[model samples]
Target: MADQLYLSLWFPNFRFEALPAALVSVLRQFALVSGEKRVTAASVYPISFTESPVYQRIYVNDDRAQSTEDSIIENAVAEATEQLHDDMAYEFEMKWNLWMPEGNDTPISEAALDTLWRPHPSTVKILGFGPHFDQATYEQNGHIRVDFGLDTPWVMDEEQEEVLDEEAQKHVQQNVEMLLAFTLSVEKNCGISSRLLWTESGEPLAEKLIARLQRLN
Candidate 1:
């Protein structure tokens, strides 16, 4: 149902401290290439959006490929670990439907929004939308919090949706959990993870995610 690309890397003599910084630096490269507004690297489930790697499959389509951030990530890994000559980079496998929604709660509507707008999943046009934002979020000792504005991530007020009604707040909370779940799933296989809390002041999850986030192609 879904396609999964698994990459396992072994870097010799790589210190744990250096590994974390290496991942963070490479992630920063991702934000720059994808123009993603925000990301959290400290979560148990890490996720980011650029474009559909499938579009670049070349085995079938290419014209519809908006961009190939997925490939960029792959190449980034090679370059990232290049300094560590002792490390060996090998393994490139793709399985279908790896990121299927299945029983998750991100909602098709919000996902669709991310599909169309937000981070411009099909192209790099998102840069024209506005400045990008990055963040660091963590769950330590069962306590969760986030530091937004990688560059300057503050609450976005498209209109005045700052004070969300109770129902709206609940919806936001749900999607936040859904995002966490989805990101975590990818991280489980990719050796990366992220958890970023998004609180919709008064807007719907679909509106906020689609308008603000960049979905996986």
Candidate 2:
């Protein structure tokens, strides 16, 4: 797996003015720890990796979670709107950096993957394996598309097959399923218009996100 998987969210109908308060309300519900200085605020949430506190992260294990959070973001958008048909969007992102050691293919169990990945029954609708690419400069091309639900086995790849057995593959599949479910959950909750897009880059995140948003529009 790569060193990190980046997930970005944007509202196709929200403006920049909807932030701070909107973000604060949504973060509070998820029990995030935030630090604000003047106009800048940083929020942190602790997420479990393999049942241990490897590093900070977050997750949603239920479907209603999306609806609940969506309401908060939507309300913020409504308040920030000046007209009846304002078409601004909120652009945000989340990244999952590999906290655990890379070369440790300890063959996770299927049951465990199920618990970690599948947060809801409807999440089972995910497909495995996204479109393959061989370009060396793909990550920096800036043409990346966010295709979470359509991809099958989104987590595992050929490298995993080289290390894991059939059983392990199955477990990884579940993990991918859970990833899909979780992605959907965030999309619903955060009220994002586009799917989660990923890439590896040395450029600023804000610049990358703005470019992607232009493409979507």
Candidate 3:
């Protein structure tokens, strides 16, 4: 089954006052890896995730023209973290392209499988936690968390009982490489003390990917 994926990052001796800079660094790393320089939106949630955002800004609105400065990683982070507090969370959304299968009800033939998958833009969320937000959830979720949404792009339709052909394997491998590169970049560039890539189902993603690749071999 496909599961939600997340990357948790912890910084050494992190201080609450440095969250905005940390958030900007992480977002900049994301832009470098994903090639999507502009943050689409940003939100500041007070107390917990259950509460409505105290501050929200959508840069991609159709009614407003986005200025060059408006999308800058530093500017977006500054805007969202302007009302920074120990009981709030800051979230930024950005786009990253990944190979995904087009929606089709019919079973795809091996020869047509390659044509069904294409590089599509996916929204990824990078959130920085305040010390007291969500009851100090950062102690477990890390100081910063990246929500990559679904794990489908990495493993492909595992439940379908379909074997990946060479072309299909190529696309899947590319997606995995992109993910690894991004993870490495974030760790290397963001001054992260430790990082973890996890799934909502509590299953290790590496094991599933290894199994899938073993089948391909």
Candidate 4:
């Protein structure tokens, strides 16, 4: 038998289990929501793990789920498989302590669940690319250089757009902006202990788009 455990995301501040309907709707891609504003993506976090979570349960809905006596590994896959009606892949998010698969023996999917713990393919990847942009500070020279990137593989040319297309180009630009916003929000959450800061765009862009973001901000 293989090991498995529950997988969950913990938001200590909010009493509600952090699962949001919008986030679930975008399960095929990344979804970041701070109050009202939101950002989305395709494959934001990817995980290829040697081991599974402490709990092997995976849920595909907007609601938090638990493992049942009849809920075996095959059943969980059936659950995730049922939700695969859409066009893309998605990672699983578990609220901390609610439910997770446990283990390290073999990848949870193939292994039979002897214990409650088993590997969830989605959990294996979500931790690699955290649900949100987790900020990491790097000190270079005398300044701090904040760095961030998508947790999952950022798909650049899914539809063979590697060639050339106006719509594809615009989509690529929007993707970059989405990633940038994720990085910025995470940086703000870090304990900077500062009252004021300046902002500027490091990349070149059309003047019109730049002005639009500024106006909206």
- lDDT (tens digit, per residue) of candidate 2 on 63-110: 634543323433333332322211222222222211111223322222
Report every candidate's CA lDDT: 0.28, 0.32, 0.82, 0.28
- Candidate 2: give its CA RMSD in angstroms: 15.3
Q: Model 4: number of clashes?
A: 41
Highest lDDT among the candidates is held by which one?
3
Comparison by TM-score, 1 against 4, better one: 4
The list of candidate 3 runs beyond 4 A from truth reads: 61-66, 104-115, 156-162, 210-217
lDDT of 1 by residue, 1-217 (tens): 1111111222334343354344434344335433442321111111212322211122111455565443443353343333332112111211111121223333322233222212112111001000111121111200112111110111224332334333333343443343444334434442334423333232233344445433211
RMSD values, in order shown? 15.3, 15.3, 3.2, 18.1
Model 4, 16-95: lDDT tens per residue?
A: 12222212322223234212111111122222222232234433332343424223322332343343211222334421
Predicted structure 1: lDDT:
0.28
- Distance from true location, Cα of 158 in model 1, Å: 23
Tens-place lDDT digits, model 3, residues 1-217:
5689999999999999999999888888888888889899999999999999989888863456645678788888887887779999999999988866665222233325445777788889999999999999999899999999877778555544366566767777777778878888988888999998899988888666667667766
Give me candidate 3's TM-score against the actual structure: 0.87
List candidate 4 stretches off by more than 4 Å: 1-49, 62-162, 192-217
Measured against the true structure, the TM-scores of the candidates, in listed sequence, are 0.25, 0.35, 0.87, 0.28
The local lDDT score (0 to 100) that residue 130 gets in candidate 1 is: 6
